[model samples]
Target: MGLFGPSEQEIETAVNAALDKRASIENPSVPLSSQNVLSFLGLDATSSAGERVTIESALGVPAIWAAVNFLSGTLASLPLHLYKRGKSGRERDTSALGVILHDAANDETSSFAWRKYIFDQVFTGGRGVTFIERSAGKKVINLWPLNPDCLTIKRIDGRKVYQYKDGKRTVTYEASEVIDIPFMLKRDMLSHYSPILSNREAIGLAQAVTKYGAKFFEGGGVPPFAIEGPFQSPGGMQRAADDMDTAVRKASKEKRLALSLPAGHKIHQLGVDPEKSQLVELQRFIIEQVARIYSLPPIFLQDLTRGTYSNTEQQDLHLVKHTLRRWLTQFEQELNLKLFGRASARQYVEANVDGLLRGDFKTRMEGYARAIQTAQMTPDEARDMENRPAKGGEADMLHIQGATVPLGSQPIRGIGDNGGPPLNDEGNNSNAA
Candidate 1:
């Protein structure tokens, strides 16, 4: 200790401790080192059901797999278009960047495949990152996907950057050079919360239920049981138990209806049966929980227990509005920001969700008819939407229904030349046509 107070080293240590505490308070996420240790010890996010729910294990649950696949595939199947603001209005952009976004992301990856992969990563790993390759003239040429597992994000000089570890070297990219979409961003903004990880307990329970059902059926629909026998020693009791187990398994395998045990031995069921435990109901409930995690209806996960004709139709609209719309908007904005830059207001990217209605031909046709009749869309535009050839001439011109006309322009049949009905002596129509 110093003469009047603590030593310089002690003061420094106290200051460091305070700073560390404040940092922990501000950023509550686990440190990378601690996460590594937890992972190494196989203790990361173990659930009450004793299942370790990682991304792979969570996906092993059929409901979770279906949710991720359905969402990613649906979003990827939508048509993405690039547009440019012009004097007339917004027009489709036919530039190389447009082709890259709408058709192919690179020479080897189609746009749909790339988008699916990106969203798969987002749903599974919490983040999707893609690097933009630019030519000498600063024109974007190709887009390459980066593995989120090997990437680290940090804020340097007030701007976020990505450092990706390649096979042997580390490459750093500016924020503008990469497109990043996170399922959910944390308060720190440097890390993201993975859907699989955030709800590990629920997913783990689902996995546990699936495993339990599989084991139950594997034993020929028999619940686990115990053996009670009149044995003289431990070895004799063990042998008797083993014999009983072999006999039961053999009987099940050979499709025999009966299993014979020794006169002195008896079998006792150890646990409740599947039906008593409500395993089927539990499994269906788990599916609903997973659907909730993805903001999807249970019907989408193939759970029709509560589905009705009216509610199922409403669920379709709910999927598009609540679930798909959020993801589509996020993806579109991310692409526009990364591909066009913040200052470039003229160019943007969009996803055409109208393709979702193509499967319902009646609904699509009705929508097109309304749009054309109201002059919101030309007949040729509606035909093009359906991939049909235009009729040319009048088909390209906007046309409204004949019954819709300017107000106060209808002619009065009985009016005089002065635009009033000729006054009879008693104020009746004169019939002066």
Candidate 2:
């Protein structure tokens, strides 16, 4: 049958087969690579069960169900461990360290110095498209992304206006109000480079606005720069290019090594960890394979990257590959221990463990299915009526009396003569009921 969806048992059996293969190959002296583990199960490394049309998930949908079941199961086990630790008069500890570095060569600083450093130097700031508008008060104005072609300026008060610029940025100011001049650049220019700018550098290029500030305010002037940095630089534009070069060099060196090395070492040497690489490579392989089958990334990576600045599509893929590789490594280690007679008692420990240890995916899936089926059925008497129907022509009609009807029941009508019930002929309307 097509592998789009497989029965729970079928999924279980396939997973069991993969586990058996893992036991066999790992049981011997030979170590297993991530690639080897995939090959043994005839699995494409990149795809999830959801994507692949062929090659069923050996672990099955129930297994996936079990994985989710264990999600809370695993988390629930944590409190007890913490409690045990608390009894021992010990507690988990965490720490954070930070250092501020000044760009002495820039010769400028400001109150929000740190912001400049982070956005420009660290993030490699570049130009971006933003909208600018005057508030309803007319005294206040805002700068945001500007539409590239239409140049539509949407005010905070929900009014939209079209603005025209003749290759020049226009920063309008009220007669009494003061505002900072905006630096505008083409949208395409921002996309051409990274999106970080250093405050110190921008400050160095900034000119003092003494006349305007002195005229409007009692203060002498706003400083030449109000931001501090390691400023934006043309040199930093090559950051991505430099990163690519380093990656290429690393790859070339790793490829020159022998393939028989331990998988962990191989991955590490390539500047990646066995437990946390992206699945892009694996996915590519799977696409080349049977052109189907998909898998989720590991739990830890998903947890780490969820809803954060560090989270990205690339990061997600990295975590998936990393976790899968790590699992494969662990499997290989277990097998080696078995072969060497080092872990005789612990052999098959993973498989032997109950749902509490392995995962509770199956229980949850069945529970969910039951819940869904129940939800689809009508409640109370409606459900009962659907299960039972009276005899005769009326039985075909699902609706009875004034109520609507029930599931699985057909509709019917009673008529006289030809296609109707036998009509009474004793002075009763023969053709009418």
lDDT of 1 by residue, 1-433 (tens): 3333332234334445555654686765544333344544343578889998778989889999999999999999998998999999999999999999899999999999999999999989788889999999999999999888778777799899888878789999999999999999877667778899789889989989999988887877778888887889999988887887777678889888898777877789998999999998999899989988999999999999999999998998899999999999999988888888888999999999877645487888888877776778888899899899999877777777553332233334444456665556655667655
> Which residue pairs in candidate 1 have backbone atoms (N, alpha carbon, C) closer than 3 angstroms, thus clashing?
none
Q: Model 2: residues >4 Å from true position, as ranges? A: 1-160, 165-271, 274-433
Least well predicted 10-residue stretch by lDDT in candidate 2:
96-105
| Model 2: per-residue Cα lDDT at residue 199 | 25
Full-model lDDT for every candidate: 0.83, 0.30
lDDT of 1 at 431: 67
- Minimal lDDT window, size 10, model 1: 403-412
Candidate 1: Cα lDDT at 50: 90
